[model samples]
Target: MTICRLEVSNPAFTPDNTQFVTVHSSHLNRRHDVSIYNVNAQTENVPIIVLMHGVYGNHWVWMGLGGIHHVYERLRSEHKISEFVLVMPSDGGLRDGSAYLPTKGHGNYEQWIMDDVITAVQKTVENVTINSPLYLSGLSMGGYGALRLGAKYAEQVSGISAHSSITDLLELTEFVDHSLDAYDCRNLHESNIVYWMNKNKNKLPPIRFDCGREDILYSGNIRFVEELKSNGIPHIYETFEGEHSWEYWHTHIVQTFEFFSDIQTHRR
Candidate 1:
């Protein structure tokens, strides 16, 4: 069990309950950046929440310009949450994000996260175990990653939260340029959150997602929710007053953490 290589120095402290570490992933053959925020480092057996970033964004997007750590600190301080570790990983070496997929020639980005990233975290963080509860959440492209992978790997996670997710990878045409052959396109479609959720309905974990009314992907999110409803699958879907910007994601991420917290409580 070789976790990814630690390519960076020891954890650097900041005022916002955050730490930065870089790990080299053999899967991707590159160094992957990760940002961790431990609300209570001494706490044990708490869920590890992986907060993935959207396209053109690295691990820093959530805590940096988005001020997510600040919001999370506020929520935790206000007694809205129990302590949890936040793992933010960069979608490395992709021109327009990997969509966290294992595409041809590029590399197995999925393995990079599921194995290399998780192993690196366990090795870097004290007392982290294979049996520790896990959760996933992300925004935009990250939302796609969280929802799709969360469902695809449902056995490994308790729940998932997606914000402004690209429920359908075809929707990505609006944002990125691609010259995919039929197989690549089909493979990507297969990984669509809605598609995979249906395929894994029996194993689906608690799922919640929200999108802003002003977002271009709002219709897609609504359609996805409808599909879930039609199939008798359970999930939480919300529409708020903002757009696809970080402002919307930053403000609402607290709701996501709260959702995961509630799931942890009831499952106990």
Candidate 2:
């Protein structure tokens, strides 16, 4: 990963247990910010969860809107989950969204997440290292990114969890105002979630996803689950009672935290 320059915020100036990092990435040829939450900075060998946001959202969405830091703190205090460093990153600053895919003219948003984001976290967080377990997660378009990228880079990820995901690239049209041509890539398969999951099926890490029963993407998620079943891919899928609102994600994200914590405990 080629980072032209790096900048980290002063912890004292930021909210408790949270900091921001800015990386000038060669992949995107622009500076992007990442919001990090480390409840206990002195703890080492903890897992890192990279939370990608959906369309029209930036790095602060997870904490600012979802209150993920508060969720993490509550989960830890209640002894329901293990320690983790939360990393929230922007989606390459494309029009409405980047879909976290590499485009011919739009720069490699995929590489920005798979490479630059990880590198930034390793550098800026003292508790995070190259060897620490990494988890991928997100909401809506971000959910698609987590599922696709986690499958494509299975060897590097420990687990994946997505909420109300867009199963295919075409689904982006329903949410964004930009034309599909903006996401054009040499290999169409690169934009497909099932393609990567099938290609790396054998090496895939633990996978799970959920959708609100009333979400517009609910039908797509059901079809996706069926495809996974027919292909014999191992995953966990569930439906909740809510819509595609922040309230739904805020309440359900606890499931993902618990899932990751269970995986970590088993690994130990």
Top candidate (TM-score): 2
Across residues 69-94, which tens digit of lDDT does each residue of candidate 2 receive? 88888998999998899999999999
Task: Please give the range of 10 consecutive residues that has the lowest summed lDDT in model 1.
Answer: 179-188
Candidate whose lDDT is highest: 2
Clashes of 2: 0
- TM-scores for the candidates: 0.92, 0.97
Q: Per-residue lDDT of 14-102 in model 1, one digit per residue for the tens? A: 54455677876677776778887773367676578888788789988887878877877798899988667888999765877788887
Q: What's model 2's TM-score?
A: 0.97
Give the Cα-based TM-score of candidate 1 against the true structure: 0.92
At residue 254, give the lDDT of candidate 1.
Answer: 85
In angstroms, how far off is 92's CA in candidate 2? 0.8
User: CA lDDT of 23 in candidate 1?
Assistant: 77
